[model samples]
Target: MERKIVKVGNSLGVIIPATYLEELGVTYKDTVDMEFNHDLQTLIIRNQKTKPNNKDHLEQVVKGIVDKYLKEKGL
Candidate 1:
């Protein structure tokens, strides 16, 4: 597939097609990682960010800490 770079204010930006976006599970307000390949002379794209677990780990750690304190306080 080929794409043209258009001028965005002072920088050049390329628009991604909806087909490719859906195929790659990309959506609006999503972060994407971009890298330049010195060897292949191409642009490399990846999802560098990690999805946060729904269950809060910090809350669990805090609960454990609070439980230990309560036990020590004899409450």
Candidate 2:
């Protein structure tokens, strides 16, 4: 698909179709890696898996494991 660069505030940007983003399993607030390939004259976009910062989530997971271990040891 062809896209034209449009003005975005002070910088130019291209509008990526929503369908393309959906197909790639990406949504708003997701981090993507973009690189320019001079040899191929193409721009590569890839998903950068970002772990969500959830202190409560981590505590819950660790607590679950510790509880299981304690149960197994009967302590």
Candidate 3:
């Protein structure tokens, strides 16, 4: 889905749809972790409660970013 970036106070932000937030298991006032994959030109957001603080999880995130980059570049 395409969403427009709008000005929020002095910063820019996008309004995530309620359905998407529900799928992510997050809601207003809930904390989330966000990461920008510069190589893939992607923004990833994860529900903080579900975020795994482990080496394996970090490896998986990196692998996913690499895979997306490769797919986008048709490597």
TM-score on alpha carbons, each prediction: 0.58, 0.61, 0.67
Candidate 3 TM-score versus the reference: 0.67
**Per-residue alpha-carbon lDDT of candidate 1 for residues 1-75, written as tens digits (9 for 90 to 100):** 889999999999999898877755778888878889999999866554644354774676588899999999999
- Which of candidates 1 and 2 is the stronger one according to lDDT? 2
What is the RMSD of candidate 3? 5.1
Error of 1 at 64 (Å): 46
- Model 2 stretches astray by more than 4 angstroms: 50-75
Error of 3 at 63 (Å): 15
Candidate 2 per-residue lDDT over residues 6-54, each given as its tens digit: 9999999999899988855689999888889999999977556744358
| lDDT of the candidates, in the order given | 0.77, 0.83, 0.92
Point to the candidate with the largest lDDT.
Answer: 3
> For candidate 3, which ten residues in a row score worst on lDDT?
51-60
lDDT of 3 by residue, 1-75 (tens): 999999999999999999989988998899999999999999999899986769988898799899999999999
Instruction: Give each model's clash number.
Output: 0, 0, 0
